[model samples]
Target: MPKLRVVSYNVRGLKDDRAALGEVIRDLAPDVLFAQEAPRRFRWRHKCAELARSGGMLYASGGLPGLGNAILVSMRVTVEEAWGLRYPLTPGRHLRGAAFARCSVAKVPFLAVGTHLATDDTERPAQAALLAATIREAGGTTIFGGDINETEGGSAWRTLADTRTDAGATNQTPTFSVTNPSRRIDALFADKTCTVTSYSVIDTPAVRRASDHFPIYAEITL
Candidate 1:
């Protein structure tokens, strides 16, 4: 069995305390990191690379191409393929997309998707559907993660729940507005083939200063 830790976070476009952001990320020591709100313009790629290196991880995929999503990986992970998808346009809505990678850790393979759904209630369902479809098309034990911008009862959340295990649901940890911390918008959903070994919302002074949302991680075995 191969056990790996996956983390999902929203960096708020690197407008906050980046050093604290790097500190908390390094502390979590994730194998795969699903980052939402990555710098989307003006040297975005270089910024993404710097962000990944800060945590001793490699930038794998996503960023501008995925709208605001990005994925980073630890050295132990081998990335076989990497790509991104921009979702269909809905009038007046900001674009959204997903970052994907076919990766293997310790020789056990899986597909990793990093995404950020629409904050507008009207746009989330379609984005969620696209995410699910991407996972289906990729066809493997998939690790889906990032900010869905809704609660467990929301339609978009339920749509994703239909095909994957909510690795952080049971913990019921809220992950938004670090100052208040009352909403649970960030998550990690894994295929049934993976067993959840442990899950947690990484919280500390550094995490609070990192971004508006706290990062969540889960230890899953495949």
Candidate 2:
């Protein structure tokens, strides 16, 4: 089976150490990037395009209208279809959304989704439920990545993990507070049909300085 390298990152709206971020992403050479906190304000499309081009990739979808969630794909993958979705907004809370791409690498197809859930404890569970339903409807070997904003034993986490494999469930590497990490809030989940070959929390110096949260990487076979 062919392996697909995927990365999930929270770039903090590309507001910090963008150069280092670009370098780290380039070095990782991910086939697909599930980016959270992507630029969503003025000239967001231009910024997303520039970031993708700088990282030697093409803008696949998401961002702006997707409430800052975005996807970038390397040329090795062929995107069959792509779309963005906004979660129902909760009054007075941050707007959340997700991006979906049905893609193929070496002719093997899978559905990928990128998202960021609300930081509010009460809000996250509902959001996770909606996200899981969306994934169920996506159909195919499904892969999801995001800043879940909740950790192990949390309702939101459990909701998503109920049917999918949480890549970090056993490893439990912290991926937040880049300088002195102590939380495992970011993660990747995949359908059982997909094999999770390897997973890691990227913690190199460049990655630490790139954003408030470290990137999580995974290798999956379909």
Candidate 3:
């Protein structure tokens, strides 16, 4: 079986403490990192690009203004396709987007989607449905990760797996409010075709100071 490490983190627009951020990534060494609330400015993207190169990961970030959601994968992984999603309720601003990257871990091809959903109950569910549909259309074992901003048992959470039958959904272990560490706003959902071996919340006190939301880590066998 082929296993790969993945992480979903909201970097807080690169405002995270630099040293802590670097250390977190270095320690985890995730094959794929999905980051939300990342700045969209050129300087910000350039800085992230630099980090991706230096950290041995490739980055794909392009959407609307202000902290565009992004996906960074290891050099060994290949991004075959990508897409963006816009909400009908919110439109133009507060735009939420999702991207699907086709890649392999240890030569095992799999699909990974990076996304950040809305806070509104109805909109969030609709967005989740759209993403689920997008993955089904793509046709393969898929994984979705990012700061969903929704609580456990919420409509959005419910909708994520509503359209897919071959998939198993896992609420990412708690990852939020690095300082206090209360709710779990982040998540990682994978298909039944994918086996989850382990899950972790990686936002130690030091790392918490780096960003508001901690990183959710998981290991999957394909």
Candidate 4:
């Protein structure tokens, strides 16, 4: 079995917090990384790709030119295909989307998703469903990491539980809002077919200082 290390981060780029994000990725050395809030700051600013390369990884991101998600993987992994999930305006912010990369690590196939959902109460459930649907469409039993901006006991959790083919909940940890640091807006969720051997919140302060949110990590085996 391959020891799959994954990370979910909301790097508040296109803003003041883009500086410290790269160091966090280097320190964690995750095999697969999913990032949100990758807004375009300039025409040539490839923050996501640059961060991935700095961490010795490859990256593919771009849905609506900017304001989407990104998936980064180490050189050891092979990415088959990747795309973004564009949600509707009712429950989505239109430009807000989830990015996916169908990848193989050590001969094991898994799908990675980078996502962000609307903060509105009614739209979040629909957005959650979209994520699960994306996972199912990817053939199930994959690793999902992102800044969901929802707590474990919220409606989004209930919605995900209903849509998931697997049996498990969020890590029940906190990851977000570094300025105050009290809620868990970031998370890692895996399919029922995957087994989570370990999980933790990364304490890379330099990384934390780069954005308003921190990163969540998990060690999964299948």
Q: Which lDDT values do the candidates have, in the order given? A: 0.89, 0.88, 0.71, 0.70
- Please give the lDDT score at residue 22 for candidate 4: 66
Per-residue accuracy of model 4 over 1-222 as CA lDDT, tens digit each: 787878887877536444466667877888888777765445424665676776666785543432467787877778887777777776334457688878887888877777788777678888888777767777845777666667766787666655343212435445767776788767677766777877787766686577777777777885
Which segments of candidate 3 are over 4 A away from where they belong?
Answer: 60-67, 89-93, 162-173
Native-to-model Cα distance after best TM-score fit, residue 180 in candidate 4, in Å:
1.0
Put down candidate 3 lDDT per residue, 1-222, tens digits, no spaces. 777788888878767686777678768888888878765666766766766764567775433422367778876677766655554557544666776667766767788777888866667877777877777788877877877887767877767755432122354445778767778878877777777888878757557666888888888777
Clashing pairs in 2: none
What does candidate 1's lDDT look like per residue over 124-204, in tens digits?
998888888878988989987989999999999999988679997788889998888888988899888889889998889
Order the candidates by lDDT, highest first — what do you get?
1, 2, 3, 4
Residue pairs that clash (backbone atoms under 3 angstroms), model 1: none
Work out the TM-score per prediction.
0.97, 0.96, 0.86, 0.86
By lDDT, the better pick of 1 and 3 is: 1
Model 1: per-residue Cα lDDT at residue 220: 89
Residue-pair clashes, model 2: 0
Q: Give the higher-TM-score candidate: 1 or 4.
A: 1
Cα lDDT tens digits for candidate 2, 101-163: 899899988888998999999888888888888777777888889999988789988988887
Candidate 2 TM-score over all chains jointly: 0.96
Clash count, candidate 3? 4
After superposition, candidate 1 runs with Cα above 4 Å error: none
| Backbone Cα, N, C clashes tallied per candidate | 0, 0, 4, 1
In model 4, which residue pairs have backbone atoms overlapping below 3 Å? Answer: 166-192
- How does residue 192 of candidate 1 score in lDDT? 85
